[model samples]
Target: MSKVSNRTKIAAALVGVLALAGSNLVAADPLADVQKADGQIHADAAASQKKVDKFFDQAQDMLFEYGTVADERESLKAYNDYVATLVADQEASMKAIQDDINGVDKLRQGVVPLMFKMVEALEQFVALDLPFNTQVRKERVENLKNLLSTAEVTLAEKYRLILDAYSIEREYGNFVAVTTGQLNLDGKDVLVDFFNLGRVALYAQSLDQKTGWMYNPETKGWDTMDESHLRELTKGIRIARKQGALDLFALPIPAAETAK
Candidate 1:
């Protein structure tokens, strides 16, 4: 009975040891599971931080691109304003040029008719003036008339020529002149030296220097000069020809008619 009791105690001790080992294994499994869950939480936090850093970098790039676009837009606006001002100035200049063109056309129309009347008046004046250089003066008037009808000459040039002709006519009364020509006395052409004293008086002397005649404007005829004036007339002729020194001499001049 004692031996059987000892065997039963040994079996109870073995069962107690197995129960303690199983309880220790259960507690170690729960600690391992908690450590694994903590590691997974740390990994998730690191991934979220990486995603935030990438989003921040993209936002910075977008801000820089927006600023660049704004600056370019302002620059383009300034350039467009400058171009608009230049176009406005060009338009104003074109308008002024057109106005000047219109004014020139009007001036041309008025000037052309006035030139014709001036030419006609000049021809009449030359025909009625003293007969000295008659043919040359008449031909000058005829040339001006022909020039008026010509298409090659410009209006300004024609006006200048006409003014020059008038200027020459005005200068004739300022000086004495002498020319050799024929005189119709007794209906015969006789060679004579003609002397004019500033459009005041005209005289003719034969080549022999023995006789002289005065032109009578009243009758349009030649009248014999007194023999007493022959020497003085010859001296006057010499002075006119620049062959003798300047000196005073007496000659017959036509009397001026009183205004009636």
Candidate 2:
């Protein structure tokens, strides 16, 4: 009986040892599966973080490019505005210049007819004034008439010449003058020295100083001067010619006509 009991105890101890070893192996396999799943999760997270970092860098680059574009647009806009202002100023200046040109044309039209009337009035005044330098004065009037008819001379030039002629006529009334010319007396031409005392009187003396005459504006003729006045007339002629010193002298002048 003792030997049978010993063999059974030994078989039971061997079965317990095999069951404990199987349990340990199953637990170790489960633990190893959990560890592998955790490792895979950590690797996936690291890869996702890398992708996020790349996306953030791309976004930052886009933002910088947008800012650069915006600044360039502003600069271009300011340049365009400046150019537009310059164009506006040029347009205004051109309008003003056109207005000035139009005004000049209108002024030219009015001034032309006025110049003609002024020249005509000058001719009439010269014809009615003192007969001294008559031929030259009439010739000036004739030349002015010819000038007015021509197209070669400018209006301003013609006007300037007419003014110069009027200035010369005005100067004639302020001084004495002497010249030699022919006088028609009693249907004969006589050589004589003509003396003009301003616009006051006109006298003629023969070359020999023997005969003298004064102009009669009332009759438009030469009146024979008396022998008594001949000496004074000779002295007056010499003074006008600047051949003698200035002195008081006598000559007849036509009385001014009263206003009618």
Listed in order, each prediction's TM-score against the native is 0.60, 0.62
Instruction: For residues 1-260, write the lDDT of model 2, one tens digit per residue.
Output: 69889899989888889999999999999899999999998999999999999999999999999999999999999999999999999999999999988898797899888878877987888766667999898888789888988899987798898888888888988988899999988999999999987677788999999999887777777788999999999999898888999899887666778100
RMSD of 2: 7.3
Candidate 2 residue 174 C-alpha distance from true site, Å: 1.4
Candidate 1's TM-score: 0.60
What ranges in model 2 sit over 4 Å off?
1-97, 258-260
Q: Indicate the residue-level lDDT of 239 in model 2.
A: 89
lDDT by residue (1-260, candidate 1, tens digit) is 69889899998899999999999999999999999988888888889889888899898999999899999999999999999999999999999999988898788899888888888997887665556787898899999999999989998899899889888888887878889998888889999999987667778999899999988767767789999999999999999998999999998777776100
Q: Which residue runs does candidate 1 get wrong by more than 4 Å?
A: 1-100, 258-260
Q: C-alpha displacement of 243 in model 2, angstroms?
A: 1.3
Report each candidate's C-alpha RMSD, comma-separated, in the order given: 7.3, 7.3
The number of residue pairs in model 2 that clash at the backbone is 0
